[model samples]
Structure formats: C-alpha cells, structure tokens
Target: MSFTLHKKEKLKSKKLIEQLFAEGKSVSNYPVKLIYLKTVHDDGSKIKTGVTASKRNFKSAVNRNRIKRLMRECYRLNKPLIFNNIVGDYAFMFLYLGKDMPTYEHLEATFKLLFKKLIIKENHEKLN
Candidate 1:
C-alpha cells in the first residue's frame, strides 16, 4: 500500500471527534499523545486520523501549524506499521503536548515508538 494519506482517510467528523475525546483510549509518548477509538464501518477498512496542537501549549498559529505538519509527516511515513496490526476501522487523534518545539528527527523516532505501542495496545484490547 502507498504511504500517502488520502482525503477520505482524514478524520473530519465533529461528532466523532467529540465521541473520540469522550470514549477513546489514549497512549502517550512524551511530546505526543494518541487517542483512538475503534469504529465500525460497513467495509471494515480504512483508518481515519487527525492531528492537533493545543493552543494552550503553542500560542502562535505558526508554531501550531508547524507541529501539526511534523505530526502528519511522521504519521504518514509510519502508518503502514500500524496498518499491519489493525483490522476494521479506527479513528485517531494525535495531540502534541510538548512545551517547546521538537525537531523532525525526534518526532519521527517517537512516531515509530508510538506505532509499536499502538499495535500492542490493540492486541491487549482484543484480549480484554
């Protein structure tokens, strides 16, 4: 599968977003927190994702945009790692939580770790 994230895979449901924050399970790795919920779809395909930079942490819009860009890039590159471990549909929101700006290298490494954690997380959820 291609590493490109399509428009269809971008999470944009306001209702789902609210539900996500209310009912999702979260796992964090320092500068990033991933909150995800398994969603049922007729096709049982596709993982929709969103990214956010808290206004509380990054006051400037530029800073927030930059952090979101980095988050998306890292997520796009490593998503295949997650796709291998997941089945059906899931909606994910990646929240940036760092006090200061983080480098692309640091974000990339952390994203990799997050992917691994997500796989383990899903496996555990399946067992419970």
Candidate 2:
C-alpha cells in the first residue's frame, strides 16, 4: 500500500466522531492521547483517522493549525505501524494534550508506542 494519507482515510462523519469520543477506548502516553473504536467502513482501508489541536491550549488558529500540521505529518508517516498489524477496521482520533508545541521526533516516537499499544489492545479484544 502507498504511504499516502488519502482523503478517504479520514474520519468525517459527525455521528461516528461523536460515538468515538463518547464510547471509544482511549490510551495516553503523555502529550498524546489516542482514542479508537473498532469500526468498519465501505472503503477498503483498515484505519480512518482524525486529528485535533485544542483551541483551549492554543487560542490562535495559526498555532492550532501548525500543531495539527505537525501531528498529521507524523501520523501520515508512521500510521502503517498499526495498519500492518491489525485485522479489522478502526477509527482513531489522535489528540494533542501537551502544553507546548512538540518536536516531530517526540511526536513520532509517541506515535510508534501508541500504535503498539493499539495492536495489543486489538489483540486482547479479539480474544475476549
């Protein structure tokens, strides 16, 4: 599969987003919190992702956009870690919870760890 973050891979349904935040399981590793739900889509992708940078922390749109830019790029580059390991569909929201902007290296490392946790999480779910 190509390593491109395609438009179809984005989570855009308001209802699905609401359900995700309301009932999805969440895992955090400092500065980042990953909320995910086991969900299927008509599209053939294994993962659908959404990203956020809270307005409460960074009041300006530019700052929020920049943080989102960094996070999306980090996720785009590293998402296959989870995609290659999972068996079913999943919707993920990667929330930035840090007080300050993080370097790409920090975010990338956290993302790798996060995907590993998600793999373990999915495995446990399958067994249960």
Best by lDDT: 1
- Kindly list the per-residue Cα lDDT of model 1 for residues 1-128, writing each as its tens digit: 78998888888889989999999999899989999998964444578899999999889999999999999999998898988878778999999999999999999999999888888988987899
Residue-level lDDT for 118 in candidate 2: 80
Q: What residue pairs are clashing in model 2?
A: none
- Residue 85's lDDT in candidate 2: 85
lDDT of 2 at 101: 83
TM-score of 2: 0.94
The digit string of per-residue lDDT tens for model 2 on 14-95 reads 9999999999999888799999998888889778899998999999999889888888998898877877888888899999
lDDT of 1: 0.90
List where candidate 1 sits over 4 angstroms from the true fold. Answer: 42-45
TM-score attained by model 1: 0.94
